[model samples]
Target: MTHNTDLPDVVPIFPLPGALLLPRARLPLHLFEPRYLAMLDDALKTPQRLIGMIQPNKVPGRSGSGLHTIGCVGRVTQFSETEGGRYMITLAGVSRFRLIEEVEGFTPYRRARVSWAGFERDQGPEEGDTAFDRGAFLQTLSQYFDSQDLQTDWDSLKEADDELLINSLSMLLGFEPEDKQALLEAPCLSTRRETLMTLIEFAMRGGDGEGMLQ
Candidate 1:
């Protein structure tokens, strides 16, 4: 799709820990806070309705938390204004970027000049990037789900491609913030798959199956 520009030079940043949005993946967000609500309002008027999802330097409750340098940029694909004057929207991941610096903006939310130079592959079409190890993922999934008393469609799992499988699970699961960040910052899809397997295995072993993504 041709855009106003080939790439967005700057984007509004959303610092929500544990929210992982990979390229082509979708993330739904609720905007109630004044800062983020305002950010959404401004983004709607821009050429590219893009928002950068990143983790905080420190978890919100912890001290010294600012924002992470690496994040995935997403475009607003779905939106709705709630009766309570809130916004419910979904973002479709566009590409990953590295934050250079935060720029002062009128919006209450923070803005950053980010670089997408190294992630050229993310913008273009996805190839059969990597061979998905369905058996391994299912084996671990079975154990975790069974232990958690969760039921899912085996057929759907079988049909989902590697990217969808990994990103879907990553977003759906209640992994810890750090673990989620690790999966998001994974160098490639293959690496994310491997990290996912490791996480699942850990969750499976942790008693009662509510693996707290250590």
Candidate 2:
């Protein structure tokens, strides 16, 4: 793992579409793409099984085929070997990075020179939405879960800290791709929480009152 320094020696990158990972959160990924499989193998061999998760600008073989500028670097915390030699791994997010430049590499996966200078500032609880009531949020989540018939281990849920609870909820909920990205890019925890509340409200509304005529 790279220390909390301005510059680092090596930066490992993992680019995918519509996937967002935030700091202090966990993301589980299944390796199937040949290029990414190679990337995962290379990462596992190294000390910092660290990968920068960026969104691809366009689909492969399409006109615009590149990735976005900013992404988070996650380190492999747990991994499992599957029957087909595929990997089931969980990444714990560390910090965000700004893409500096792409380097030529042997594998198909993209490699980039990145810098952490941009993300060193405050990513604290959001302003204006500072009046967050955790108790109310939990009660609301319980009601929402009941309505959806979703079962959770209440003891664990009750024990989760503010950051973990909010990030986990935002990640698992069935939000639109754009919306999910928005939540991932939110600058602070309060903003994320506020965005989640809006999402929860929308879900409660059910299809925005416009379903198929059938």
Candidate 3:
């Protein structure tokens, strides 16, 4: 496990909208673009093998250079190369970071200097959600999944711990980019769970009062 101090002050960033990586979560990426491939190559050479996963802000009039201030950093825990010259890698989330500024560089991909302050909890043990209502949450999730025509391993989800279940859902769900960013920026497990439930309920309602809950 990498501590906050062990993380670098600057890291190559991957600005992917609608992609949320939470602490202790794993995000698998398929990198084919030449710039990202180069970024991966450079990252693999470093000791930490870290990459900042940030989202490009889509707010009106700020789409060009605006990015959400917060992002999660992950370590390259698994890697493989495909015959098509693409790279498949699994990044194990280390901690969430605050983007300080974009570093001026000649690299093909973007890089940023980040601060890990106020996020020390990200490197600690898994958080417990005492307020979590698994049965009710699952009921709502089941309805949401059914509405979206999504399928998953129910048994696996049932066995997962509270943090895993909520964070996984927060990351993997097809929510809007801003909603996903909200989940990522949640201060704690319980807060994230609450945000996730609200998002699910809103989705079930079709974002308005039109659709009936399944």
Candidate 4:
């Protein structure tokens, strides 16, 4: 378990669009790019084995390739080297950090100094959503999945608790990058659940929805 004092001030960042990692959630990544492979190598040497997962802001004319202000820091909990020099790793999210500044360095990947001031709760235990409407949410999800031609284990989703169901959907859904960011930046579990519900409802009503398990 990671505590507030255990986190580092600066860490390596991987800017991937549409990839969201919330606290207590897991993100699996495939690293074949040379720069990211190097980044993984360096991260493994650190005591925390932490890496920042952020999305590249797609808005035009923004600097530093337009990184979002907030990103989640995750520890490399699972790692395996594959054939063709590729790496597969699963990151267990620790906390959300505000990007203070991008550090200039010779390393192939980007690093940032982050502030964890507002997200101390992320280092604590899983949160419960008192206002979650699981029945309605699942109904909407079923409709959306039908529209997208997607499939999933409904039994497992029904069995998952509020945090796991909401967070997992927020991570796995095919919403836009900005929508995913909104979910990530949400202040709490209930807000994220609301945002997720809205996104799904919007997608069902002719929004640009794509990507799902078929």
Query: TM-score of every model?
Result: 0.88, 0.79, 0.94, 0.95
Model 4: weakest 10-residue lDDT segment is 205-214
Off by over 4 Å in 3: 60-64, 208-214
Displacement of residue 11 (Cα, Å) in model 2 is: 3.4
Model 2, span 115-213: residue lDDT tens: 776565323331333577978887888877877789998888888777777888877876665566667667778888988887777677675422111
- Ordering by lDDT: 3, 4, 1, 2
lDDT of each: 0.81, 0.72, 0.91, 0.90
Best by TM-score: 4
What pairs collide in candidate 3? none
Q: What would the TM-score be for candidate 3 when compared with the true structure?
A: 0.94
Error of 4 at 133 (Å): 1.6
What lDDT score goes with residue 164 in model 3? 93
What's the number of clashes in each of the models?
A: 1, 0, 0, 0
* Model 2 vs. true fold: TM: 0.79
| Candidate 2 ranges with C-alpha deviation above 4 Å | 6-10, 57-66, 121-130, 207-214
- RMSD to the hidden true structure, all candidates: 3.2, 5.0, 3.4, 3.3
lDDT by residue (72-145, candidate 3, tens digit) is 99999999999899999999999999998889989999999899999999999999999899999999999999
Preferred candidate (TM-score higher): 1 or 4: 4
